[model samples]
Target: MESEPTAELIRAQLRRLRLAANLTQEDFGKQVHFSGSQISAIELGQRPFDRLFLKRADEVLNSDGLLLGLLRIAELHRQPHFLRPWLDAERVAQQLRCYHPTLVPGLLQTEHYARAVIRSDDLLADDEVERRVAVRMDRQAILTRPDNPPILIAVIEEATLRRVDESFRGIMTQQISHLLDCVQRGGVLILVIPAEVSVHVGHAGPFTLACGADGDWVGHLENHLGGATIDRAEELATLHARWDGIRSVALPKGQSELLMKEVMESWSTI
Candidate 1:
């Protein structure tokens, strides 16, 4: 059987601790880890901490009861661990910023294009590929949600568009067409980083930012090992600065759309 709900187990335990000790959520997070927002996330069943976080929690909160008693119940639901924070932020963000270097970002990929991209990784078993693809498709619904459907800003490298003539040309065309629709609908902002523009701060890899309704922002950096979610103010500011630099180096939206439309038309030759 699945363990009792992870959120409930954690919230109950944390509430009792705070109440019995007469601590505010702000005080509790300061005692336990980082900030009031973090404690609020824990108490509201919106977040969970890692194992080593226990050691820090113990040291910070002065509670020997256990660092993360909820992990046993929550670990079963974990996948890639790296993506958990992305889901949490994505579901709440008012706007999203993504910079892609090679392939399209997952949020905007069509099923066929996504499948082809995944299949390129020979290490992924058939089942694992399906699971990953399903996870991505599940995220796509956020684009059309009635409330807080995020405004997406995507800055993609021009070289990536060259793959439009690859095996899954139709899918690439559809993805480009989808972008056109999104732009016309005012739901997305697309920019193309031309190969000629040689200078960029994010040249090493891809990153994203999820701006929350409360005005809080978080940054995500993806790597072969997994990904990184940054909530620290200074770090987030640095990421924002870098993204601004990238945008300045990219083509204006109208020009980029025209470029994409022209190339998509060229796909007929493939």
Candidate 2:
């Protein structure tokens, strides 16, 4: 198994490299187009660094992809512990089937929408929220990875598309537009369970099922507290049955896209 590096490890390396280069934090920050205080915060572990920061830092320090490599590994550590196993499965799965009843699936969410979702937890600190959002965005890379990208099939409740948080101005419009673009891009299929269907098995909660190239399967279930990975045969069977039931009521791809466009227009008016 691959090991994950801690934030402290990354911070220490940054400081060591910057010092070895004989540059003050301010000087290094100038080269990276960031303020000295920002560099100080990162080195002191007072703030979390995003991928862009790590990339620029690596280039400036001539680490030859060292920091960038750490960034990828660090993403795993940033995710909630309960979700890591499923995340590993998601990275290697040949196909991913996801169902969400109240919100857009994380794999397909835009950055703005993701930020809102993370921030919805008022108890979380700003840095923690940003870190989680970064992980969510990075997970999306698998969808378009040059290598055999997984075929993603997502089913979302129609209310997810119609609901808009007025506080976030154009968030819904941007999110719906992104979904349409994903549909146009191929290798992805998104269907919607229309609101008219008052009852469904999906109401039990959101779950994801992944199929591996080797004919194995992994399941994931999420609730308010946390999430769990499912590999047990009986549990997998139940999830599979629920998935079929939910997919049965969802609109076909063509109808789904049309409904999404209609919602997008409605959001634009708001």
Candidate 2, pairs of clashing residues:
none
Per-residue lDDT over 121-141 for candidate 1, one digit per residue giving the tens place of the 0 to 100 score = 999998667656756676777
Total clashes for model 1 = 2
Candidate 2 structure, TM-score to reference:
0.86
Off by over 4 Å in 1: 1-78, 164-166
Instruction: Write down the TM-score of every candidate.
Output: 0.69, 0.86
Alpha-carbon RMSD of each model: 14.1, 3.6
lDDT of each: 0.77, 0.88
Find the number of clashing residue pairs for candidate 2.
Answer: 0
